[model samples]
Every structure is written in C-alpha cells, then in structure tokens.
Target: MGTHYEGDLRVALLDAAVLALGETGVDGLSLRGVARRIGVSHAAPAHHFGDKVGLLTAVAARGFELFTEHLAEALSGGEADPVAQLPLLTRAYSEFAENYPEHFDLMFRPASVRVEDPEYMRTSGIAFEALRAHLEECQRRGWRGEADSAALTSAAWALAHGIAVLRAHGSLARHYSDPTLDAVEDIAVSLLF
Candidate 1:
C-alpha cells in the first residue's frame, strides 16, 4: 500500500466532496463515500466536516474559488476594450464548464444541490464580485451606460450562463447547427456592443 501522509483533513474532505458531488450530485453524495474514495475510514469525513452539508459547503467554496480564478485569468489579457474582454470571459466560463463538468453542474444546477451556508454564500460572492469588478472597469472605460452596473453585470452573466447551460445540456446542438463558444460569444458581444 502507499504511505499515508496528511496535514489538513478538512482539505482532504473537501477534495473528496468535490469528486463525489461532481459524480453523483448532492442527492447521491455520502460522507462515507467520500471517505472511502480517499482511502479513509467511513467515519473520517464526518470527523472533519461534521455532516454532508458541511462537506458540500466546502465543495461549493472551492468551486467559487476556481471560477473566480478562471474569470480573472480570462480578463487579464489587457485588451483595449474591456467589452471585448466580455466575450473572452464568456468563452472561458464555458470552457471551465466543459473541462470541469461536475463542478459546473454543482455550481449552477438549482435542484442538484443547495448551499445555503454562510461560508458558501461568502465564497459564491467572490465569483460575483470578480465579475462585478470587471463590469465596473467597463463603466470606467465608458463602455457601459449610467444605468445600474449590477443590472448590466447580471444581464451579461445571464447571457454567458444561458449559453453554457444550453451547450452543457446538448440543447444548443439541436437549434444552432454550429454552436461554438466563439460563435456564441461573438453573437452575444455583437448584440451588446
């Protein structure tokens, strides 16, 4: 057997939770399952997470962290028009979903999981704030109107999110003969700009 090394059991539990949630979703997630997948005893996850909700809170938190990181990287290319950056970020969002299907599913699916914990809320806020910061930059650059930045950001977010949802569900393939992220982003940006 391999050597057993560990420091933060919480981190281990979170990692396992992400894998389990991604595979089976919230309804199918089990503390024992996570523990087993990590090669630990069935009781191990409960020792660190207290319960399933705690474990999911950690998973959602990590997902938001990753989402924020991806968005930030997508926006960092220093394009002259931050509005142009919108399509890039949108593509990045969809790419993240395609690459991490489970994480994407858990992050957006309403019925699959419920993360009402305050810590989860705070973590989710990080992703929202990242997007809001970009929108604020757009307003500063005169790309946006004097209207509410929050509303504008929400609209843009919805556009990207809708495209991602359709693509993930294989719905876009039905309607749009060629539903590439670049095409989706191009159409969305053209409509906005």
Candidate 2:
C-alpha cells in the first residue's frame, strides 16, 4: 500500500503527490502530507516544489505528458479508418485516467494548478494535438462534417474526457454492468461516429 521510491526524490515527491491526490482529493493534499508519504522531511517537498500549487502543477504537467504518449500510441495503432480510430482514442483516454487518476484529477482542476503555466501549456498542447490530428485525418478521408477541425477536436475531447472522468470516479458503475471501460467507450464513441 506504499511506494518504495528509489533514486530521485523529485520523482518520489511527484509520485507521493499523485498518491495523496487520489486518496484525499485536492483539498486534503499538502506538501507535508506528500513528504510524510515519501518518508522525507517536511522541508523536502517545499524545497523541491516550492509550495502546494507548484507541486500539483508539476503533477499536472506529468499527467499531460503521459496522456499524450498514450494517445499518440493509440493513434499509431493499425486502425486506418478515421471513424474506427475514435474508439481506440476513447479507450486510451480512459486508460490514462484510470492508470493515473491523481494526475488526471489535477490536470482537469484549474484551481489546483495554474492553467496557464508554461509546462501545462506545452504538455496540454501535445495531448490536444493527438485529437486534433485525428480530426484532420477524418476530414481528409472525406467525412462530410461541416465543423472545422478545432470544433471537431474539441467535441471529441469533451466526450472522451467526460467518459474518463465518469469512469475514474465510478460514476459509470451504476449504468454499466461491465466494469471494463473499453465496452463503455466503444458504445459511447459508436454514438458519435
């Protein structure tokens, strides 16, 4: 029930912040708690991350990077049909949220971290580009949607992100008999395409 973090304290601190966020939510998260989780002195996190917002911002940045990586991998999978790619992308989005719920929570909650922070700006762009690129590909493939790529991508992200949030917080549990997220994502994306 605990991580035995080795090598880098910064990594340990990040992991600890994520773990704390998942267990306690944003209000309960603090630098001291993260230090306690990692068996470090209270000053350790303060020195490493400066403050609570700073620590959570770092977590958000990492979340965006991880999310983008998974999304890119899903896009690169052997699904050439643009319509077919929606399900893959949905599944990948849910997977990232499930695998890193703490980071996911921090990434979406603007108050926890500065939404305009440079790290967040860059990393979120990377994540958003995956969806935008897919929408462009769909357009090029002769999909007759009139909306621009930005609009399409925004809608796609909203649906995918909504599913991930629901699944992460168990909101989907009441509706779906199957706890596995893939079926839910497939069904949801099926409605869109």
Candidate 1 ranges beyond 4 A from true positions? 1-7, 78-80, 109-114
Q: What is the lDDT of residue 130 in candidate 2?
A: 70
Clash pairs, model 1 backbone? none
Candidate 1 per-residue lDDT, tens place, 82-120, comes to 767887888888878887776677676544445676766
lDDT of 2 by residue, 9-66 (tens): 9998998888888789889998888888878788888887789998899999999999
User: What shift in Å separates residue 126 of candidate 1 from its native position after superposition?
Assistant: 1.4
What lDDT does the true structure give each of the candidates?
0.77, 0.82
The prediction achieving the highest lDDT against the true structure is 2
TM-score per candidate, in order?
Answer: 0.87, 0.87
Taking all chains together, the TM-score of candidate 2 against the true structure is 0.87
Evaluate residue 45 in candidate 1 and report its C-alpha lDDT on the 0 to 100 scale: 74
Candidate 1 to truth, TM: 0.87
| lDDT, candidate 1, at 74 | 77
